[model samples]
Target: MPDQHSTLRAQRRAETQRLIQAHAVRLFTERGYDATTVTDVAEAAGVSPMTVYRHFPTKEDLVLIDRHGALVAERIAASPAERPLVGRIGGALIDSVAALTGGGHGDDLTADERFLLARLQLMISTPALRAKHLDNHYALQQAIVDALGDDATDPDAAFHVRAAASACLAALHTALVRWAEDDGRTELPELVTKALAAAFGERIVDTPR
Candidate 1:
């Protein structure tokens, strides 16, 4: 009974956080970023202003964090080390996309994809948001580095892994931006795979037997 209650409570908390984030985005879209207040979002979400603040400490975070970055980081960290480094990274990226889109691998953007695209658009349109996004890039890279582990201890392998990670990350960002600009006409997985191939040559697409 206690375990069930804890599970229910956790579920409710997640729901509340999602509710707050959704309302905040709506408010941001309807009103300008500067014009939207925490109180307004709280009212729309049917939660207290403090609750909104607790869920998202800053307005920028409300737009920047969809929790997908953490998901990708977790997936990469959990990925088996025996695979080729780029292959592992690429597979982890695809897994993250699948989880984010609720299991679709098609060209069309899911509802969640659209929501994230809106946030990306918002960030690109606002200078402050763009700066915040850049700041987050390092943290995201660090997460990848941590996931990749002692590859960094050896100078040669360290350089190679860092370069590979950077190329992969750049490929991902390019794919996302291209998808947004094209209005989701192209499949994200295809774009991602293509970008990685271009960046890493044929190795990214090679399958292990």
Candidate 2:
């Protein structure tokens, strides 16, 4: 009974956080990000300032909160261990994009994809957000490295894992940048696969321009 109650509480908390973030994005879009305040987002979410602060410690947190690292890590951990590390990481990245976009493109974007697109646009346009975005990428790289479970006792193996993680994430970042630049007309999963192939010396096929 206690465990069930805790689970329900967690679900409710997640719902509240989602509601607050939705309101924050809408308000940030309506009024420039710089022009909006935590108070404003709280009012838009119909929650108290305290509640907003409890969910998002900083204004940037509202825009920068991301679950990509967890998604990538889970996929990498679940991938066949016999596969090359770079291939596993790269495949995970492409898979993550497919999951996010529902394996579709253009008008078929899922609500999550649309939300991510908006966040990407804001991050690219805002200098502060852009800086934080790089930090987020670094964190993502670390997550991948951790997921691969490189032996800390072997410096060479650890270094190799870190390098592969960084390289794969760079490819993913390039794909995301191009996706944002193209206004999401191209299929994101395709772009990710192509980018990873080029980076990892795999044969590249033409992706929709």
Candidate 3:
């Protein structure tokens, strides 16, 4: 039932994505994200000059985390139909801590996660990654705007829904920065709830370090 050309195209795109990510992760681990060049990735991936550019326009795009957008879309899509957007978004936010930190590490990450967090902290502290992070946030906000518009029938109501969405994401960001300092010993989901509540009202009781 599937169209062969469409299926082939999907396969090609997935392969290209894998190649790009593979090379990018290497350069990121070696010379660091900021110092790594697109040319370096192309050479490492054994692709033509234009092919690399075709997949990722800028070097930052090579490592940008659009996974956040995917998660946001999935979160909203799975929510109850009749719940208010704010409540659903809030619940999704509070529920997403597991998805955020629950995989890949085999044992207590006290050491491994420290190195992993250091990698993330490296990205966060780098100007290039920070710029990419900002770009990612704006793109994510636009997606939230689109999702809000889809869910709200009243033209005037959508704006408020999106504003609440923005607040929720901003709360998540605030909590992540604080969590990063803890080096992943503590759970981020708990911090997310406190941060979301604080963003709305009341002093968020930060879990004791």
Residue-by-residue lDDT tens digits, candidate 1, 1-209: 99999999999988998888877877787787889888888899998888877878887888876666677678877777777788777767766766765433335567787676667667767787888887677666666767777866777877887777777788888888886677666666677778878877766556441
Residue 108 miss distance in model 1 (angstroms): 5.4
Task: In model 3, state the lDDT of residue 84.
Answer: 57
Q: Estimate each model's TM-score.
A: 0.83, 0.91, 0.73
Cα lDDT, all candidates: 0.75, 0.81, 0.66
Ranking by TM-score: 2, 1, 3
- Which is better, 1 or 3, measured by TM-score? 1
**Residue 8 of candidate 1: its Cα lDDT?**
100
Residue-level lDDT tens digits of model 2 in 12-112: 99899989998888788788899999999999889999999898888898988877889888888888777777878888887777777765567887788
How well does candidate 1 score on lDDT at residue 67? 65
- Model 2 regions more than 4 Å off: 150-153, 203-209
- Residue 62 displacement in candidate 2 (angstroms): 0.7
> How does model 3 score by TM-score?
0.73
Backbone clash count for every predicted candidate, in the order shown? 1, 0, 0
